[model samples]
Target: MKTIQYIAAVLCSLVLSGCSDFSDSINTDPTRPGVASGTQLIANAALYLPGLSSSPKGEFMAQYLAETQYVGTSLYPQESTSFYSWYEEPLMNLQAAIDSDDLDAGEGPIANQIAVARILKAYFFWNVTDRWGDIPYTEALQGSDNFTPVYDSQESIYNSLFEELKAAVATVVEGDIDNDIIYGGDMSKWQKLGNTVRLLMALRLSEVAPARGKEEFNDALNDGVFSSNEDNLVFRHLPEANNQNYWYGQIVNQNREWWALTETLVDEMKPVNDPRLPVYGNPARESDEYVGLEFGEEENIGTEEYSLLGSDIYAQDAPVYLVTYAQVRFAMAEAAERGWIGGDAATYYNQAVEASVEQWTGSTEEVADFLTQPGIAFEPGNAMKMIGTQRWVHLYMFGYEAWAEWRRTGYPDNLVEPNGVPVPGRLSYPDNEVFNNADNYEEAVQRQFGGDDDIHGKVWWDQ
Candidate 1:
């Protein structure tokens, strides 16, 4: 079991050996093995899934956490961050697995392997397009044939991803796969993942394309979604040094006490006596209470004055949650409120809150009491606002997804950074694009933002 968990980490190092930077060329690591097994590629791709939720950049954008020392990220100073590592590493491996002709039924069904690869590829592309707006999709992964691939619009990418996810789900066959670190070859869980991702992706189109959003959401829900917390997509970190949680590397290994709960989050949860507060953070040293630092404050505040993350959160073997049942229920609640589904919004809302509480605290002991509170209870008048706010809370460490939700719904409308710069709608393109792929990059920027490739520009779906 331990060796199984370490397979992805091993493959990552082997595949990426001696590769300094992968941005210049389409083919990375020319010295590495060219024809890796489908299973090996799949394992390599799975390794990157944990970083999606654990990213500090995402946490800062979402305002769930703040910097205790160096506060550059909290102030949102990054104009361009690279997507090259994503494409070069996980995305490339997934694409290789999908395109591989190796038929080893002993490892797993070829159909199933391809299906999983396609699903993962679609997910990686979804993340990229959401962050960068326009990215190389159609012309990507062409190796030496195309060094400069044209950027696809976010709208086109989303449309293609919808089709890809549906196709991948339909392609699944009966078989357990080897080197499957995530679900241990549980095909049913993979099916649920496919549907749940499709459902969430569909909901993202609610504001911009309501009719299509309703159709896709209903389709995914009808097919199937996560039935319970058991079906959540989580990446469990290994205790090994190479596979340790990202937080462990920062706080435990390096002795860096740089992160704390943000005032925006602590105030909201503490005031409501949110049960997850204790599980989310430790009490401040001076106050002996859960205290959050004002986000982006330039003052050299004492680290002991604010709450640090819970011990379990930074543990080496901690599990990173990619998606959860609570998120699905919240989506259902919103769909119900939008008249897109045949269910009571309050019932789903209540279920969502209960699930979130259970998921965080590992028990439902406080759920009944928590729900009855005047402010916590569902109010029909403020249905959408309530759903959005509660959903934001449910998405504690899953920062990028939460940030994307905030952009789409504009709920928790009180997120004010004291620095006076409004939260960005999307990340700017990386410098590699600006210099290497200048023509295509400039074209994308001009088409999307009227020649300005800044973080403030909104994507197609942020209408």
Candidate 2:
């Protein structure tokens, strides 16, 4: 684990010796790419999985729902740079690595890595399409085959991604495990995460393609899904130097601005006096020193006595959550509550809250108290809402995660749309898609708002 892994991870650029950039061609053994077959690529990339295990580092920007309330203000974030990086660089590059070899090989690690890479690629693209309408796909990663990949319709991309995950997961061959981290090469967990991804993506599809999304999701869940935490797809962080909390570094090092708890999140959590609030918020120096930046702020305001968009930030000690047991439980809670699956929402609902606190703070009693709060407690709604709400709360550091959830569920309904940056409501197409795949981008644009650049324009699936 001492070596960094780039297998579909940002650390890909981190290089074996920590080179600041990894955008150059990857040659595991610079003297061996010519002789490297599929096995070599797979083994090398698969070996990268151990490095993919990013510690509890940054603020859970994925879970933070960045675009919703964290942005347009001083969240002290790296914009969508990190999000897009995960999508375009690590995720896309890993997929390209596979084209280096055939996907139909006998039992081997590269093939397995390719199959898993495809699944992970689906996950990455799903996030990209959901957040930003049109994105480069077909020709995007060809590198040279097609210098530019066209932006596919958000709907088309979703359908294609869903299919990719389903196909890759189905291609699992027995005795094919060389470099796996989530399961230590155990293919069983691979099956679980793939199924879980299907279920998760399917549900999200409903917002854009109701009948299709629901139909697809129901089919996957009915077959089998992540039954427990062990089956979860998460990156556990080691509390070590250069591998500490992502958001922690800023807070501890006084990285100037940080995306703190908003009045909405703070107030919502405070109703039952959610103890997690303390775990989530940073008290400003004085009452007038408060500045809460919600989503949609036009500009960043310095600490001039504080504002509501982001008056305060969370502690540096906060964890950078990827996916978690609580999230899966919340997903189940929503499925059960809504009859998407057969179970009780209350059970999964409480389970979600409990799991979240336990995962966040590693305390069962703390989670129980937080769940008892009226907001987190279950009532009657889409199991989606219940689970989604917990997801948002639990997503303090994982901004992008909650942002994706909010796009799908609209829970924790206290969304504010401030002016400036136009709220981008939807994500902008990637530069590659815009430049190389001009035709696809044009098609997607027509389907959206007749070529309007407004983020408010809904994609076909979204509509």
Best by lDDT: 1
lDDT of each: 0.86, 0.54
lDDT tens readout by residue for model 1, 208-238: 9999999999999988999899998888887
For 1-463, candidate 2 gives per-residue lDDT tens digits of: 4223323222323332211123365645454222333333333333323223222222222323222223523333223322345534445455555565443354355556667767666766666666666666765665446754556666678778777877887777776554343455666677667777777777676555657866777777765667755566654334444444444454456544534445556556656666555455444545643334443343553333333222122232223345466776777776666566777878877877777666655567666556566666677754556667667887665555566666566765666544322223564555554565577667877767787655465655555
* lDDT (Cα) of model 1: 0.86
Model 1 stretches with alpha carbons more than 4 Å out: 8-12, 16-35
Give lDDT: candidate 1, residue 381.
100
- The ten-residue window of minimal lDDT in model 1 covers 15-24
TM-score of predicted model 1? 0.95
Q: Report the C-alpha displacement of residue 309, candidate 2, in angstroms.
A: 14
lDDT of 2 at 458: 60
RMSD of each: 3.3, 6.1
